[model samples]
Target: MADYNRWMNERLYDAAATLPEAALFEDRGAFFGSLFATLGHIVAADLIWLNRFVQLPALAELRGPLSALPAPTGLRDRVADSLPMLRERRVQTDVVICDMVRRLEPVHFDEVVRYGNTAGASQAKRFGPLLQHFFNHQTHHRGQASTLLFQAGVDVGVTDLNALIPHEA
Candidate 1:
């Protein structure tokens, strides 16, 4: 998992690094009219999930001037900041998940995880499902970014999880 994550993380940054500010902020018909907005959403979502696992400040609770990365230059710098945060969150949450997995003798994958939902309402869902949602959410948005990158002529290579894994020793 670590090696695979490391490889993908490196790829993400490499792809991000190649993009020009103009391309990064181009309105390619993404959710918010720009690739930069879509990338911001991805970073924000990662932070939200991290908050759920590690008791960090909720992304929703972050009230301040939102840094507008409306240009490819600004977007790339934001991506630079976001990649490390995503990596740190992944490592920290993975530790918590590993501990949870190890401690359970008869694991209840259906155990509920309570949190506030998107509409600002409190909610609960099975842990297994939520974890699945977290990774799936990441993949979904990353694909959006990848598509945008391709449209901008940046080749974001090999995103498949299978390719991320190491061969058996």
Candidate 2:
């Protein structure tokens, strides 16, 4: 899933780069209002979740790097106002996610993750499900961003998950 996240972001950004600078940030009446804001939201939310994940002992190695990414106070908070900065953060965060999944143990999956939501509500859930939610959240918003791109006359080709699946030898 980490690979999928990175792959999709790369494709999306590449496609987005083709758009005129004004259209890239123009309000399209979407959930986040524009492609830039949507992308920024993804990075911000990702850093938020990574902040929580790094609190776990198993993911301690992630602490140092993730600390460099700003912790978004709210989901809509802009993590990067420029496309280049946003893309850089996305690449960095994806690397941390790949590192995190590589280090997961069976025990870590079932362990409860306790963290506050952006709403400041208390929460406790198993790490496995929380991790699932984290990835799902990305896909959901990415889909929206893709649609926004499409509406603006850009087509992101081959978004199916199967595109990333490896064939057995």
Candidate 3:
């Protein structure tokens, strides 16, 4: 999953880098209003989840780049003011996520973590499913980002998970 996340992000950022600054920042009517803003939301959400995950006693030893990142003032806070800065932060965040996943033990997944949602509601759930949501959330926003990219004339080739699967010999 970490590999796939990194692979997709590389493709997305590569295409995004080719886009003109005005086009990338233009309001294209996407959920977050613009491609840059949408990407910022993904980074913010990832940091928020990683911070929550580390709070679990079973995962207390886990730490990475996210620990040093400033908490988003809100879910929609712009973590990066520009596309170049956002891309840099995105790569850093992805590395932290991959590193965290690489260090996870099976027992850690079975533990439940308690944390407050962005809405300020308290919640508790198993770490396994929470991890699923973490990755799924990335894919979700990336889909929106891909659409934004396509509308701006960039092609992010072959996004299917099957592309990463190994075939039998």
Candidate 4:
């Protein structure tokens, strides 16, 4: 899933690069109102979740560059003010996510994580489900981004997960 997330992100950014700066930042009625903003939200959320993940006692010893990174000030805050900056940050964040996932042990999956939401509400949930939400959140916003890209005349080709699946020999 981390590889798929990275693959789609690369494709999305490549397509977005073809767009004019104005079009990239233009409001297109997506949740965050623009492709740039939506992309920013994805990065912000990833950092938030990763920060939370690092806080887990079971995962503390595994902290590295990801934990050293600062958390976003808010859910909707722009981690990067421009497309190029956003793409750079996105690449770095994706690498961190891939590394974090690689380090996880099977036992980590069953452990519960406790964190506060953006609304300041406290919550506790199993680590496995939280990880699912982390990836799902990316896909959900990426869908909005895909729509925005299409409306702007860019098509991200072959988004199906099957594209990543290996065929039996």
Candidate 5:
């Protein structure tokens, strides 16, 4: 799972890195404005989920959708601006999840986690399924962002989960 996460992150970064400032801002009809806003949404969602997993104060207000579109930044700018925060938060989230999994002698797969639904309705749901959805949600949106970037003439690198290796060679 760690390898999968790391790989997905790298592929996401690689795809993001290839996007030119011009293409990044070009409206591809993606939510937010262009590829840039979509990417921003992905980053924002990841941050929110990680914050909850790590028990950190919510960094930004929990909103259903992005409001002010984030401007396109260069590859370097994105690396400098978002990667560090995302990576750090990801590590913290992974650690907490691993610890929780370790502590659970046997978890009930059917057990649900209660939370406020998007419609502001109260709900209870299974845990493992929700976790799966959380990760899958990232992949789904990132895939859209990647496609938008490609349409805009950028090349996001290999996206397979099996392709990501640890940072250490």
Candidate 6:
């Protein structure tokens, strides 16, 4: 799932890069309003989850570095206003995610974590399923971005996870 997340994000960013600046940030009335917002939301949400995941003792080393940037205040925050900056942030976030997953021990998944939602509600859940939600959330918004891009006449090409599967005899 981490690999899929990275792969799809790279594809989306690549496709979005071809568009002129205005089209990228135009409000099309989708959930996040535009391609830029959709991607920004993904990065923001990923940081939220990464911050949660790093709470586990095994991942504590990542906590400080991930804290370097001010945590996003809300999912709707326009975290990055430009393609270049957003793309850079997206890559950096993906690197942190991939590294965090690599260092995770199987036991880490079973541990429960507590976090505050954007709405200020308290919540607790197992780390494993939250990780699933993390990646799935990315796929969901990326799908929206793809549709919006297509509406704007840009194609992200084939996006199936099967494309990454190895062929075997």
lDDT of each: 0.55, 0.91, 0.87, 0.88, 0.53, 0.87
Shift of residue 134 alpha carbon in model 3, Å: 0.8
Q: Which parts of model 6 have CA positions greater than 4 angstroms off? A: none
Q: Model 5 segments beyond 4 Å from truth?
A: 50-109, 164-169
lDDT of 1 at 58: 27
What tens digits encode model 5's per-residue C-alpha lDDT throughout 1-169? 5446545656665665565656666777766666655655555554444333322122123221222222222211231134445445445444444444444323544565665544566767665676677678778877887787677666776777755554675
For each candidate in turn, the TM-score is 0.64, 0.97, 0.93, 0.94, 0.60, 0.95
Ranking by TM-score: 2, 6, 4, 3, 1, 5
lDDT of 2 by residue, 76-141 (tens): 998887788888988998999999999998889888888899999999989999999999999999
Clashing pairs in 3: none
Candidates 5 and 6 compared: the better one by lDDT is: 6
Query: Residue 10 in candidate 4 has what lDDT?
Result: 97
Stretches of candidate 3 above 4 Å error? Answer: none
lDDT of 1 by residue, 48-132 (tens): 5544533222222222212221112221224333444544543444444444334443344556667775556788776667766
Count of clashes, each model? 2, 0, 0, 0, 2, 0
Candidate 2 lands at a TM-score of 0.97
Candidate 6 lDDT over 55-107, as tens digits, reads 88888998877886547868876667799999888888888888888998889
* Candidate 2 least-lDDT 10 residues: 78-87
Positional deviation of 14 in candidate 4, in angstroms?
0.4
Q: How much lDDT does candidate 2 score?
A: 0.91
